[model samples]
Target: MAEAPSWFGEVERAAWDRFRAEIPWLTEADRVLVEVASTLRARLATDPAMSVNAIAQLRMCLSAMGATPADRSRVDIPQNDDDPLTCYFN
Candidate 1:
């Protein structure tokens, strides 16, 4: 796997901060969801041309974390405009 871009960590940190602010009752599960999102964000940043998984583990994890559709919309990972998976993840 390629190393994350020079600004990738900053992006991830910003996303995590946003997520923390949006979620009202934080849990261990929430932390896990953020971590999964961070990883996926890094992967996509490293390879924007990567194929999109129809039923991605990230989506499943979000669901398992009890994230609502509104939460999904609010707590987003940083995404490239060119990545097809961007809409799905966010």
Candidate 2:
């Protein structure tokens, strides 16, 4: 797994870890998007005063990455028979 950016706070680091865990199919090429999503999640967690638009944008980012159940259902990650967790994609 890629290391979280050094500037990431605890919340961001936690969010990064969760994304990496849940989106195991993500390649190094997806790192930027993951970082963006993690940063947005951390911002949302720490800033209750965030504007509705900002929240919506974060939700969009999460959805694009298949982080939500509905979005995940739309994704077709290939299953690796040797990896039990991959079976979840099937």
Candidate 3:
């Protein structure tokens, strides 16, 4: 895996951590989306010149990952929390 961009500061780090914590089902495939979302979030916070398209893309990415409340129900969380191997069975 690549290191996070040098521009990633407290805000980006916090967003990354929050995403990982909130979206426990994320796997290697989701890494790129997570990184993009984090970057977009930081840009939105710090860049007054950020484009509307970037903001929309960030919202779409968040919704796709079920990171937003409205999209939470779309995520199918595994019920077998006690067994790490349950993923294989499911």
Candidate 4:
């Protein structure tokens, strides 16, 4: 286990709040999702080159937290691109 990133707590919480506020239909518990996402993100930051399968698994966890591809909610994804990715609201 490694230390949680200094930015993760703030970034994750902000995303969670925005998601819940916008979707209002994510019946999944907040703590659970955040914890899971934190683990994946920490892993990503440490060694993003981790197996494609592993990366996909983490992606699945993240995708599960939001809407489908059609609904885009503007968000700051930090590292994916220079700009923040738009998260679609399900």
Could you say which candidate leads in lDDT?
A: 2
Question: If the candidates were sorted by their lDDT against the true structure, best first, what order would they fall in?
Answer: 2, 3, 1, 4
List TM-score per model, in order: 0.46, 0.75, 0.67, 0.43
Model 2 misplaced stretches (Cα beyond 4 Å) = 83-90
User: What is the per-residue lDDT of model 2 for residues 8-61, given as tens digits with 9 covering 90 to 100?
Assistant: 889999999988888877777788888888888888889989889888888888
* Candidate 3 residue lDDT tens string, 22-47: 77777767888988998888888789
Against the reference, the lDDT scores of all candidates come to 0.56, 0.84, 0.81, 0.54
Q: Pick the winner on TM-score between candidates 1 and 2.
A: 2
Better of 1 and 4 by lDDT: 1
TM-score of 4: 0.43
lDDT (tens digit, per residue) of candidate 4 on 1-51: 223335556655555555455445555444566556656655666675778
List pairs with backbone clashes in candidate 3. Answer: none
TM-score for candidate 3, residues paired by index: 0.67
* lDDT of each residue in 1-90, candidate 1, tens digit only: 122234547767654555456544455545656666656655555666656681376566556544668555655544438988878987
